[model samples]
Target: MQAPEFLAAHAAEAERAIAQVLDDRASVVPERLLEAMRYSLMAGGKRVRPALVRECYRACGGVDDARVLPAMMAIEAIHTYSLIHDDLPCMDDDDVRRGSPTCHRRFDEATAVLAADALQALAFELLASADIEAELRCELIRRLALAAGCQGMVGGQMMDMQAEDGSGIDLMQVERIHLHKTGALLCWCCEAGALLAGAGSDQLDACSRYGKAVGLLFQIADDILDATASSETLGKSAGKDAAQHKATYVSVLGLVPARELAAEMLELAIAAGSTLGEGGQPLNTLAQYIMGRDR
Candidate 1:
Protein backbone atom coordinates (compact mmCIF):
# COMPACT_ATOMS: atom_id res chain seq x y z
CA MET A 1 0.00 0.00 0.00
CA GLN A 2 0.99 3.62 -0.43
CA ALA A 3 2.72 5.11 2.59
CA PRO A 4 0.28 7.97 3.05
CA GLU A 5 -2.62 5.53 2.76
CA PHE A 6 -0.99 3.25 5.29
CA LEU A 7 -0.61 6.15 7.73
CA ALA A 8 -4.20 7.27 7.21
CA ALA A 9 -5.39 3.74 7.90
CA HIS A 10 -3.49 3.58 11.17
CA ALA A 11 -4.75 7.04 12.04
CA ALA A 12 -8.30 5.84 11.44
CA GLU A 13 -7.76 2.92 13.77
CA ALA A 14 -6.43 5.23 16.44
CA GLU A 15 -9.38 7.54 15.97
CA ARG A 16 -11.76 4.65 16.54
CA ALA A 17 -9.87 3.44 19.60
CA ILE A 18 -9.75 6.98 20.99
CA ALA A 19 -13.45 7.57 20.40
CA GLN A 20 -14.36 4.39 22.26
CA VAL A 21 -12.20 5.38 25.19
CA LEU A 22 -13.66 8.91 25.37
CA ASP A 23 -17.28 7.76 25.07
CA ASP A 24 -17.35 6.80 28.76
CA ARG A 25 -18.64 3.34 27.85
CA ALA A 26 -15.75 1.41 29.38
CA SER A 27 -15.91 3.18 32.73
CA VAL A 28 -18.48 5.25 34.63
CA VAL A 29 -18.17 9.01 35.03
CA PRO A 30 -20.28 12.13 35.33
CA GLU A 31 -22.29 12.71 32.20
CA ARG A 32 -21.45 16.40 31.96
CA LEU A 33 -17.74 15.84 32.52
CA LEU A 34 -17.77 13.04 30.00
CA GLU A 35 -19.45 15.30 27.48
CA ALA A 36 -16.86 18.00 27.99
CA MET A 37 -14.05 15.50 27.64
CA ARG A 38 -15.59 13.93 24.59
CA TYR A 39 -16.09 17.33 23.01
CA SER A 40 -12.38 17.81 22.45
CA LEU A 41 -11.10 14.24 22.52
CA MET A 42 -13.42 13.34 19.68
CA ALA A 43 -12.47 16.37 17.65
CA GLY A 44 -10.83 15.23 14.44
CA GLY A 45 -7.09 15.63 14.12
CA LYS A 46 -4.32 13.47 12.69
CA ARG A 47 -3.50 10.94 15.42
CA VAL A 48 0.24 11.12 14.69
CA ARG A 49 1.49 10.22 18.14
CA PRO A 50 -0.72 7.17 18.54
CA ALA A 51 0.09 6.08 15.00
CA LEU A 52 3.76 6.20 15.92
CA VAL A 53 3.10 3.89 18.84
CA ARG A 54 1.33 1.40 16.60
CA GLU A 55 3.83 1.51 13.75
CA CYS A 56 6.87 1.48 15.99
CA TYR A 57 5.52 -1.50 17.90
CA ARG A 58 4.76 -3.28 14.68
CA ALA A 59 8.23 -2.52 13.38
CA CYS A 60 9.58 -4.20 16.52
CA GLY A 61 7.55 -7.37 15.92
CA GLY A 62 4.90 -6.47 18.47
CA VAL A 63 1.20 -7.10 17.99
CA ASP A 64 -1.50 -4.54 18.51
CA ASP A 65 -4.34 -5.56 20.81
CA ALA A 66 -5.44 -5.14 24.39
CA ARG A 67 -1.80 -5.00 25.42
CA VAL A 68 -0.90 -2.02 23.21
CA LEU A 69 -4.25 -0.50 22.29
CA PRO A 70 -4.86 1.01 25.71
CA ALA A 71 -1.39 2.47 25.71
CA MET A 72 -2.09 4.03 22.31
CA MET A 73 -5.32 5.46 23.66
CA ALA A 74 -3.41 6.89 26.59
CA ILE A 75 -1.04 8.81 24.32
CA GLU A 76 -3.94 10.13 22.27
CA ALA A 77 -5.65 11.27 25.45
CA ILE A 78 -2.56 13.11 26.58
CA HIS A 79 -2.25 14.76 23.17
CA THR A 80 -5.87 15.90 23.33
CA TYR A 81 -5.33 17.31 26.79
CA SER A 82 -2.37 19.29 25.56
CA LEU A 83 -4.40 20.64 22.67
CA ILE A 84 -7.24 21.67 24.98
CA HIS A 85 -4.95 23.60 27.26
CA ASP A 86 -3.06 25.04 24.32
CA ASP A 87 -6.25 26.63 22.99
CA LEU A 88 -7.18 28.11 26.33
CA PRO A 89 -7.46 31.89 26.79
CA CYS A 90 -4.20 32.12 28.67
CA MET A 91 -2.39 29.97 26.18
CA ASP A 92 -2.86 30.45 22.47
CA ASP A 93 -6.42 31.73 23.00
CA ASP A 94 -7.61 30.06 19.85
CA ASP A 95 -11.35 29.92 19.28
CA VAL A 96 -11.22 27.38 16.48
CA ARG A 97 -9.60 23.97 16.51
CA ARG A 98 -9.89 21.05 14.08
CA GLY A 99 -12.20 23.25 11.99
CA SER A 100 -14.64 23.71 14.89
CA PRO A 101 -14.91 25.62 18.13
CA THR A 102 -12.19 24.78 20.56
CA CYS A 103 -13.14 22.95 23.72
CA HIS A 104 -13.11 26.11 25.80
CA ARG A 105 -15.24 27.84 23.16
CA ARG A 106 -17.68 24.94 22.95
CA PHE A 107 -17.88 24.61 26.69
CA ASP A 108 -16.57 27.14 29.21
CA GLU A 109 -13.01 27.93 30.24
CA ALA A 110 -13.39 26.13 33.56
CA THR A 111 -14.87 23.07 31.94
CA ALA A 112 -12.11 23.02 29.36
CA VAL A 113 -9.48 23.25 32.08
CA LEU A 114 -11.02 20.41 34.06
CA ALA A 115 -11.41 18.27 30.98
CA ALA A 116 -7.73 18.67 30.12
CA ASP A 117 -6.79 17.85 33.69
CA ALA A 118 -8.95 14.77 33.70
CA LEU A 119 -7.45 13.55 30.44
CA GLN A 120 -3.93 14.07 31.75
CA ALA A 121 -4.68 11.90 34.76
CA LEU A 122 -6.47 9.36 32.62
CA ALA A 123 -3.36 8.98 30.43
CA PHE A 124 -1.25 7.68 33.27
CA GLU A 125 -4.10 5.53 34.52
CA LEU A 126 -4.51 4.01 31.06
CA LEU A 127 -0.81 3.28 30.81
CA ALA A 128 -0.73 1.73 34.26
CA SER A 129 -3.72 -0.45 33.44
CA ALA A 130 -2.46 -1.64 30.06
CA ASP A 131 -2.52 -5.45 29.71
CA ILE A 132 1.25 -5.58 29.31
CA GLU A 133 3.70 -7.04 31.80
CA ALA A 134 3.86 -5.04 35.00
CA GLU A 135 7.50 -4.05 34.47
CA LEU A 136 6.79 -2.85 30.95
CA ARG A 137 3.75 -0.95 32.13
CA CYS A 138 5.79 0.74 34.82
CA GLU A 139 8.36 1.86 32.27
CA LEU A 140 5.65 3.27 30.03
CA ILE A 141 4.19 5.21 32.91
CA ARG A 142 7.56 6.60 33.93
CA ARG A 143 8.54 7.70 30.46
CA LEU A 144 5.12 9.25 29.83
CA ALA A 145 5.27 11.21 33.07
CA LEU A 146 8.67 12.57 32.21
CA ALA A 147 7.58 13.48 28.69
CA ALA A 148 4.52 15.40 29.89
CA GLY A 149 5.98 16.93 33.01
CA CYS A 150 7.80 20.21 33.60
CA GLN A 151 11.03 18.80 32.23
CA GLY A 152 9.45 18.24 28.86
CA MET A 153 6.25 19.52 27.22
CA VAL A 154 5.22 21.77 30.06
CA GLY A 155 8.68 23.25 30.28
CA GLY A 156 8.70 23.94 26.56
CA GLN A 157 5.34 25.66 26.84
CA MET A 158 6.74 27.82 29.63
CA MET A 159 9.77 28.66 27.54
CA ASP A 160 7.56 29.55 24.59
CA MET A 161 5.45 31.84 26.74
CA GLN A 162 8.51 33.54 28.07
CA ALA A 163 9.85 34.12 24.58
CA GLU A 164 6.54 35.55 23.45
CA ASP A 165 6.83 38.62 25.65
CA GLY A 166 9.24 40.32 23.27
CA SER A 167 12.10 38.42 24.77
CA GLY A 168 14.75 37.87 22.11
CA ILE A 169 15.51 34.18 21.77
CA ASP A 170 18.16 32.84 19.42
CA LEU A 171 17.86 30.03 16.88
CA MET A 172 19.29 27.43 19.20
CA GLN A 173 16.96 28.61 21.96
CA VAL A 174 13.99 28.23 19.62
CA GLU A 175 15.13 24.72 18.78
CA ARG A 176 15.42 23.94 22.46
CA ILE A 177 11.86 25.11 23.06
CA HIS A 178 10.49 22.98 20.24
CA LEU A 179 12.61 19.97 21.17
CA HIS A 180 11.08 19.98 24.61
CA LYS A 181 7.58 21.12 23.71
CA THR A 182 6.94 18.97 20.67
CA GLY A 183 9.86 16.59 20.34
CA ALA A 184 9.68 15.05 23.79
CA LEU A 185 6.31 13.34 23.41
CA LEU A 186 7.03 12.33 19.82
CA CYS A 187 10.30 10.78 20.94
CA TRP A 188 8.53 9.03 23.79
CA CYS A 189 5.97 7.51 21.43
CA CYS A 190 8.65 5.72 19.37
CA GLU A 191 10.78 4.82 22.38
CA ALA A 192 7.80 3.52 24.32
CA GLY A 193 6.75 1.25 21.47
CA ALA A 194 10.25 -0.19 21.12
CA LEU A 195 10.40 -0.72 24.84
CA LEU A 196 7.00 -2.44 24.87
CA ALA A 197 8.28 -4.84 22.21
CA GLY A 198 11.49 -5.47 24.19
CA ALA A 199 13.53 -4.22 21.26
CA GLY A 200 17.27 -4.30 21.66
CA SER A 201 19.29 -1.11 22.12
CA ASP A 202 20.19 -0.88 18.44
CA GLN A 203 16.56 -0.88 17.35
CA LEU A 204 15.60 1.39 20.21
CA ASP A 205 18.28 3.85 19.19
CA ALA A 206 17.06 3.87 15.62
CA CYS A 207 13.51 4.61 16.69
CA SER A 208 14.75 7.32 19.02
CA ARG A 209 16.72 8.93 16.22
CA TYR A 210 13.75 8.65 13.88
CA GLY A 211 11.53 10.25 16.50
CA LYS A 212 13.85 13.20 17.02
CA ALA A 213 14.11 13.91 13.32
CA VAL A 214 10.40 13.43 12.75
CA GLY A 215 9.49 15.65 15.70
CA LEU A 216 11.66 18.54 14.53
CA LEU A 217 10.48 18.10 10.97
CA PHE A 218 6.88 18.15 12.13
CA GLN A 219 7.37 21.38 14.05
CA ILE A 220 9.10 23.04 11.13
CA ALA A 221 6.26 21.98 8.89
CA ASP A 222 3.80 23.45 11.35
CA ASP A 223 5.70 26.69 11.34
CA ILE A 224 5.70 26.80 7.59
CA LEU A 225 1.99 26.06 7.48
CA ASP A 226 1.22 28.69 10.06
CA ALA A 227 3.13 31.22 8.02
CA THR A 228 1.64 30.29 4.67
CA ALA A 229 -1.67 28.44 5.03
CA SER A 230 -5.09 29.92 5.57
CA SER A 231 -7.04 29.24 8.74
CA GLU A 232 -9.51 27.26 6.65
CA THR A 233 -6.72 25.07 5.36
CA LEU A 234 -5.20 24.59 8.81
CA GLY A 235 -8.52 23.97 10.53
CA LYS A 236 -7.32 26.33 13.21
CA SER A 237 -5.90 29.80 13.64
CA ALA A 238 -2.98 30.57 11.37
CA GLY A 239 -0.06 33.01 11.81
CA LYS A 240 -0.28 32.39 15.53
CA ASP A 241 3.48 32.21 15.83
CA ALA A 242 3.96 35.72 14.49
CA ALA A 243 0.93 37.14 16.29
CA GLN A 244 2.12 35.76 19.60
CA HIS A 245 5.71 36.75 18.95
CA LYS A 246 6.79 33.17 19.47
CA ALA A 247 10.11 31.94 18.18
CA THR A 248 9.92 29.44 15.36
CA TYR A 249 12.12 28.01 12.64
CA VAL A 250 10.74 30.50 10.15
CA SER A 251 11.14 33.38 12.55
CA VAL A 252 14.74 32.42 13.23
CA LEU A 253 16.06 30.88 10.06
CA GLY A 254 13.78 32.44 7.42
CA LEU A 255 11.33 30.51 5.24
CA VAL A 256 13.74 29.06 2.71
CA PRO A 257 16.19 27.93 5.34
CA ALA A 258 13.42 26.46 7.45
CA ARG A 259 12.12 24.35 4.58
CA GLU A 260 15.66 23.26 3.75
CA LEU A 261 16.21 22.21 7.36
CA ALA A 262 12.96 20.21 7.34
CA ALA A 263 14.03 18.44 4.15
CA GLU A 264 17.27 17.49 5.78
CA MET A 265 15.47 16.24 8.85
CA LEU A 266 13.10 14.15 6.76
CA GLU A 267 16.01 12.47 5.00
CA LEU A 268 17.62 11.78 8.38
CA ALA A 269 14.35 10.34 9.73
CA ILE A 270 13.89 8.15 6.65
CA ALA A 271 17.43 6.86 6.95
CA ALA A 272 16.84 5.91 10.57
CA GLY A 273 13.56 4.20 9.68
CA SER A 274 15.32 2.25 6.92
CA THR A 275 17.48 0.68 9.62
CA LEU A 276 14.39 -1.33 10.59
CA GLY A 277 14.28 -2.80 7.03
CA GLU A 278 10.87 -3.78 5.66
CA GLY A 279 9.12 -3.23 8.97
CA GLY A 280 10.12 0.41 8.80
CA GLN A 281 8.46 1.16 5.47
CA PRO A 282 5.52 2.71 7.27
CA LEU A 283 7.91 4.90 9.22
CA ASN A 284 9.82 5.84 6.09
CA THR A 285 6.63 6.69 4.22
CA LEU A 286 5.23 8.66 7.13
CA ALA A 287 8.37 10.75 7.21
CA GLN A 288 7.79 11.68 3.57
CA TYR A 289 4.16 12.43 4.34
CA ILE A 290 5.11 14.81 7.11
CA MET A 291 7.57 16.62 4.89
CA GLY A 292 5.12 17.07 2.03
CA ARG A 293 2.03 17.61 4.20
CA ASP A 294 -0.04 20.77 3.75
CA ARG A 295 -1.80 20.56 7.10
Candidate 2:
Protein backbone atom coordinates (compact mmCIF):
# COMPACT_ATOMS: atom_id res chain seq x y z
CA MET A 1 0.00 0.00 0.00
CA GLN A 2 1.05 3.59 -0.48
CA ALA A 3 2.43 5.26 2.66
CA PRO A 4 -0.27 7.87 2.92
CA GLU A 5 -3.10 5.40 2.58
CA PHE A 6 -1.49 2.89 4.93
CA LEU A 7 -0.91 5.56 7.58
CA ALA A 8 -4.38 6.99 7.15
CA ALA A 9 -6.10 3.62 7.65
CA HIS A 10 -3.99 2.54 10.59
CA ALA A 11 -3.87 6.01 12.15
CA ALA A 12 -7.65 6.02 12.32
CA GLU A 13 -7.68 2.64 14.03
CA ALA A 14 -4.98 3.81 16.40
CA GLU A 15 -7.01 6.89 17.32
CA ARG A 16 -10.07 4.82 18.12
CA ALA A 17 -8.04 2.38 20.22
CA ILE A 18 -6.43 5.25 22.11
CA ALA A 19 -9.80 6.83 22.78
CA GLN A 20 -11.23 3.59 24.09
CA VAL A 21 -8.35 3.11 26.49
CA LEU A 22 -8.42 6.70 27.72
CA ASP A 23 -12.15 6.53 28.41
CA ASP A 24 -11.78 3.66 30.83
CA ARG A 25 -12.12 4.53 34.51
CA ALA A 26 -9.01 4.64 36.63
CA SER A 27 -8.86 2.97 40.04
CA VAL A 28 -8.12 6.25 41.84
CA VAL A 29 -11.50 7.75 40.92
CA PRO A 30 -10.49 11.39 40.49
CA GLU A 31 -12.98 12.82 37.98
CA ARG A 32 -11.22 16.17 37.54
CA LEU A 33 -7.86 14.54 36.92
CA LEU A 34 -9.45 12.10 34.51
CA GLU A 35 -11.05 14.99 32.66
CA ALA A 36 -7.68 16.70 32.38
CA MET A 37 -6.08 13.50 31.14
CA ARG A 38 -8.75 13.08 28.49
CA TYR A 39 -8.45 16.75 27.53
CA SER A 40 -4.82 16.48 26.44
CA LEU A 41 -4.94 12.83 25.45
CA MET A 42 -7.55 13.61 22.87
CA ALA A 43 -6.08 16.99 21.87
CA GLY A 44 -4.63 15.31 18.79
CA GLY A 45 -1.39 15.39 16.86
CA LYS A 46 0.04 13.19 14.08
CA ARG A 47 -0.25 10.08 16.31
CA VAL A 48 3.14 9.16 14.91
CA ARG A 49 4.43 7.24 17.89
CA PRO A 50 1.52 4.81 18.04
CA ALA A 51 1.60 4.35 14.30
CA LEU A 52 5.30 3.60 14.58
CA VAL A 53 4.54 1.04 17.25
CA ARG A 54 1.92 -0.68 15.11
CA GLU A 55 4.22 -0.61 12.07
CA CYS A 56 7.05 -2.05 14.07
CA TYR A 57 4.76 -4.79 15.30
CA ARG A 58 3.72 -5.64 11.76
CA ALA A 59 7.34 -5.59 10.66
CA CYS A 60 8.05 -8.18 13.30
CA GLY A 61 5.24 -10.34 11.83
CA GLY A 62 2.79 -9.83 14.64
CA VAL A 63 -0.90 -9.93 13.90
CA ASP A 64 -2.80 -6.82 14.91
CA ASP A 65 -4.94 -7.56 17.93
CA ALA A 66 -6.34 -6.09 21.13
CA ARG A 67 -2.97 -6.45 22.86
CA VAL A 68 -1.12 -4.42 20.26
CA LEU A 69 -3.67 -1.63 20.38
CA PRO A 70 -3.36 -1.22 24.13
CA ALA A 71 0.41 -0.93 23.96
CA MET A 72 0.17 1.62 21.16
CA MET A 73 -2.40 3.66 23.08
CA ALA A 74 -0.26 3.54 26.23
CA ILE A 75 2.73 5.04 24.43
CA GLU A 76 0.60 7.84 22.98
CA ALA A 77 -0.86 8.62 26.38
CA ILE A 78 2.63 8.95 27.76
CA HIS A 79 3.64 11.15 24.84
CA THR A 80 0.55 13.36 25.15
CA TYR A 81 1.18 13.76 28.88
CA SER A 82 4.72 14.88 28.17
CA LEU A 83 3.51 17.54 25.75
CA ILE A 84 1.02 18.86 28.31
CA HIS A 85 3.68 19.23 30.99
CA ASP A 86 6.15 20.64 28.49
CA ASP A 87 3.71 23.41 27.67
CA LEU A 88 3.12 24.39 31.28
CA PRO A 89 4.05 27.86 32.52
CA CYS A 90 7.15 26.37 34.11
CA MET A 91 8.15 24.77 30.83
CA ASP A 92 7.47 26.00 27.29
CA ASP A 93 4.66 28.31 28.48
CA ASP A 94 3.11 28.38 25.07
CA ASP A 95 -0.53 29.41 24.73
CA VAL A 96 -1.35 27.07 21.86
CA ARG A 97 -0.99 23.41 20.94
CA ARG A 98 -2.35 21.46 17.97
CA GLY A 99 -3.84 24.78 16.84
CA SER A 100 -5.91 25.03 20.04
CA PRO A 101 -5.35 26.63 23.41
CA THR A 102 -2.79 24.79 25.55
CA CYS A 103 -3.98 22.74 28.50
CA HIS A 104 -2.66 25.13 31.10
CA ARG A 105 -4.11 28.05 29.21
CA ARG A 106 -7.52 26.41 28.71
CA PHE A 107 -7.81 25.09 32.20
CA ASP A 108 -5.79 26.74 35.00
CA GLU A 109 -2.13 25.91 35.48
CA ALA A 110 -2.80 23.69 38.49
CA THR A 111 -5.29 21.54 36.60
CA ALA A 112 -2.97 21.20 33.65
CA VAL A 113 -0.09 20.14 35.88
CA LEU A 114 -2.27 17.62 37.67
CA ALA A 115 -3.57 16.30 34.38
CA ALA A 116 -0.08 15.80 33.03
CA ASP A 117 0.99 13.98 36.19
CA ALA A 118 -2.16 11.87 36.28
CA LEU A 119 -1.74 10.92 32.66
CA GLN A 120 1.79 9.82 33.37
CA ALA A 121 0.61 7.60 36.19
CA LEU A 122 -2.30 6.36 34.10
CA ALA A 123 0.10 5.29 31.37
CA PHE A 124 1.84 2.89 33.71
CA GLU A 125 -1.47 1.76 35.12
CA LEU A 126 -2.74 0.90 31.68
CA LEU A 127 0.44 -0.96 30.85
CA ALA A 128 0.27 -2.94 34.03
CA SER A 129 -3.37 -3.70 33.46
CA ALA A 130 -2.93 -4.85 29.87
CA ASP A 131 -4.26 -8.34 29.22
CA ILE A 132 -0.88 -9.69 28.18
CA GLU A 133 1.56 -12.05 29.77
CA ALA A 134 2.66 -10.69 33.12
CA GLU A 135 6.31 -10.65 32.20
CA LEU A 136 5.69 -8.80 28.94
CA ARG A 137 3.46 -6.31 30.67
CA CYS A 138 6.11 -5.65 33.29
CA GLU A 139 8.75 -5.22 30.64
CA LEU A 140 6.66 -2.73 28.69
CA ILE A 141 5.79 -0.73 31.78
CA ARG A 142 9.41 -0.59 32.94
CA ARG A 143 10.68 0.46 29.54
CA LEU A 144 8.08 3.21 29.18
CA ALA A 145 8.67 4.48 32.72
CA LEU A 146 12.38 4.71 32.09
CA ALA A 147 11.85 6.45 28.76
CA ALA A 148 9.45 9.01 30.21
CA GLY A 149 11.36 9.63 33.43
CA CYS A 150 14.66 11.26 34.36
CA GLN A 151 16.90 9.23 32.07
CA GLY A 152 14.88 10.17 29.02
CA MET A 153 12.39 12.92 28.16
CA VAL A 154 12.43 14.63 31.54
CA GLY A 155 16.21 14.86 31.48
CA GLY A 156 16.08 16.36 28.01
CA GLN A 157 13.52 18.93 29.17
CA MET A 158 15.79 19.94 32.02
CA MET A 159 18.69 20.36 29.61
CA ASP A 160 16.49 22.44 27.30
CA MET A 161 15.43 24.68 30.15
CA GLN A 162 19.02 25.15 31.32
CA ALA A 163 20.30 25.72 27.82
CA GLU A 164 17.73 28.43 27.09
CA ASP A 165 20.33 31.04 28.01
CA GLY A 166 22.51 29.66 25.15
CA SER A 167 25.59 29.66 27.44
CA GLY A 168 28.39 27.18 26.69
CA ILE A 169 26.16 25.16 24.37
CA ASP A 170 27.41 23.33 21.28
CA LEU A 171 26.08 21.08 18.52
CA MET A 172 27.04 17.92 20.41
CA GLN A 173 25.18 19.13 23.52
CA VAL A 174 22.09 20.01 21.53
CA GLU A 175 22.04 16.62 19.83
CA ARG A 176 22.46 14.93 23.18
CA ILE A 177 19.47 16.77 24.60
CA HIS A 178 17.25 15.97 21.61
CA LEU A 179 18.31 12.33 21.55
CA HIS A 180 17.10 11.95 25.09
CA LYS A 181 14.18 14.36 25.09
CA THR A 182 12.65 13.24 21.82
CA GLY A 183 14.55 10.17 20.76
CA ALA A 184 14.10 8.13 23.91
CA LEU A 185 10.32 7.71 23.67
CA LEU A 186 10.63 7.12 19.95
CA CYS A 187 13.19 4.41 20.59
CA TRP A 188 10.91 2.84 23.17
CA CYS A 189 7.99 2.96 20.76
CA CYS A 190 9.87 0.90 18.18
CA GLU A 191 11.30 -1.42 20.76
CA ALA A 192 7.96 -2.00 22.40
CA GLY A 193 6.35 -2.60 19.04
CA ALA A 194 8.97 -5.14 18.07
CA LEU A 195 8.78 -6.82 21.42
CA LEU A 196 5.00 -7.03 21.23
CA ALA A 197 5.41 -8.55 17.77
CA GLY A 198 7.81 -11.19 19.10
CA ALA A 199 10.81 -9.88 17.17
CA GLY A 200 14.25 -11.26 17.84
CA SER A 201 17.23 -9.23 18.93
CA ASP A 202 18.45 -8.39 15.44
CA GLN A 203 15.10 -6.99 14.26
CA LEU A 204 14.64 -5.06 17.50
CA ASP A 205 18.08 -3.51 17.16
CA ALA A 206 17.40 -2.48 13.56
CA CYS A 207 14.09 -0.86 14.51
CA SER A 208 15.82 0.95 17.37
CA ARG A 209 18.38 2.43 14.98
CA TYR A 210 15.63 3.57 12.63
CA GLY A 211 13.69 5.11 15.50
CA LYS A 212 16.73 7.06 16.72
CA ALA A 213 17.52 8.42 13.28
CA VAL A 214 13.89 9.34 12.63
CA GLY A 215 13.51 10.94 16.04
CA LEU A 216 16.41 13.28 15.38
CA LEU A 217 15.17 13.85 11.89
CA PHE A 218 11.78 14.85 13.28
CA GLN A 219 13.40 17.38 15.61
CA ILE A 220 15.60 18.83 12.90
CA ALA A 221 12.55 19.25 10.71
CA ASP A 222 10.77 20.99 13.58
CA ASP A 223 13.71 23.37 13.85
CA ILE A 224 13.49 24.06 10.15
CA LEU A 225 9.76 24.59 10.38
CA ASP A 226 10.24 26.93 13.30
CA ALA A 227 12.59 28.97 11.22
CA THR A 228 10.42 29.12 8.11
CA ALA A 229 6.78 28.12 8.77
CA SER A 230 3.99 30.55 9.46
CA SER A 231 1.97 30.25 12.68
CA GLU A 232 -1.21 29.59 10.70
CA THR A 233 0.43 26.74 8.85
CA LEU A 234 2.23 25.29 11.88
CA GLY A 235 -0.86 25.56 14.13
CA LYS A 236 1.39 26.79 16.93
CA SER A 237 3.80 29.61 17.58
CA ALA A 238 6.59 29.70 15.06
CA GLY A 239 10.06 31.10 15.83
CA LYS A 240 9.62 30.42 19.52
CA ASP A 241 12.76 28.33 19.67
CA ALA A 242 14.90 31.03 18.12
CA ALA A 243 13.09 33.71 20.09
CA GLN A 244 13.83 31.86 23.32
CA HIS A 245 17.40 31.14 22.20
CA LYS A 246 16.80 27.42 22.64
CA ALA A 247 19.67 25.23 21.46
CA THR A 248 18.64 23.64 18.16
CA TYR A 249 20.13 22.31 14.95
CA VAL A 250 19.51 25.66 13.26
CA SER A 251 21.03 27.53 16.15
CA VAL A 252 24.19 25.47 16.05
CA LEU A 253 24.62 24.36 12.44
CA GLY A 254 22.62 27.01 10.53
CA LEU A 255 19.53 26.40 8.36
CA VAL A 256 21.27 24.91 5.31
CA PRO A 257 23.30 22.53 7.44
CA ALA A 258 20.30 21.62 9.56
CA ARG A 259 18.29 20.70 6.46
CA GLU A 260 21.27 18.72 5.18
CA LEU A 261 21.55 16.88 8.48
CA ALA A 262 17.84 16.05 8.48
CA ALA A 263 18.13 14.63 4.98
CA GLU A 264 21.11 12.58 6.02
CA MET A 265 19.26 11.19 9.00
CA LEU A 266 16.26 10.39 6.84
CA GLU A 267 18.52 8.36 4.54
CA LEU A 268 19.88 6.48 7.52
CA ALA A 269 16.38 5.81 8.79
CA ILE A 270 15.24 4.54 5.40
CA ALA A 271 18.29 2.28 5.19
CA ALA A 272 17.54 0.87 8.61
CA GLY A 273 13.93 0.17 7.64
CA SER A 274 15.07 -1.48 4.41
CA THR A 275 16.74 -4.14 6.47
CA LEU A 276 13.24 -5.42 7.26
CA GLY A 277 12.59 -5.98 3.56
CA GLU A 278 8.96 -5.65 2.38
CA GLY A 279 7.68 -5.24 5.90
CA GLY A 280 9.58 -2.00 6.27
CA GLN A 281 7.77 0.04 3.63
CA PRO A 282 5.61 1.83 6.15
CA LEU A 283 8.68 2.85 8.08
CA ASN A 284 10.36 3.99 4.88
CA THR A 285 7.35 6.10 3.91
CA LEU A 286 7.18 7.53 7.41
CA ALA A 287 10.75 8.71 7.08
CA GLN A 288 10.05 10.25 3.71
CA TYR A 289 6.97 11.98 5.05
CA ILE A 290 8.92 13.38 7.98
CA MET A 291 11.55 14.79 5.66
CA GLY A 292 9.00 16.19 3.21
CA ARG A 293 6.52 17.65 5.72
CA ASP A 294 6.09 21.44 5.44
CA ARG A 295 5.04 21.98 9.06
List the pairs of residues colliding in candidate 1.
none
TM-score of each: 0.95, 0.95
Q: Report the lDDT tens digits of candidate 1 across residue range 1-295.
A: 2337766676677668767776655367777778888888778777788878878888887875445677778888898999999999998889999899999999899999998999999899888877779999898898989999899999999988888886477888989998999999999999988888789999999999999999999999999999999998789889988887788899989999999999999999999999998999989888888888787
Candidate 2 residues 67-98, lDDT tens each? 68777777877888889888988788899998
Worst 10 residues of 2 by lDDT: 1-10
Q: After superposition, how far is residue 130 of candidate 2 from its true place, in Å?
A: 1.4
The alpha-carbon RMSD values of the candidates against the true structure, listed in the order shown, are 1.8, 2.0
The residue-level lDDT of candidate 1 at 214 comes to: 97
RMSD after Cα superposition, model 1 = 1.8
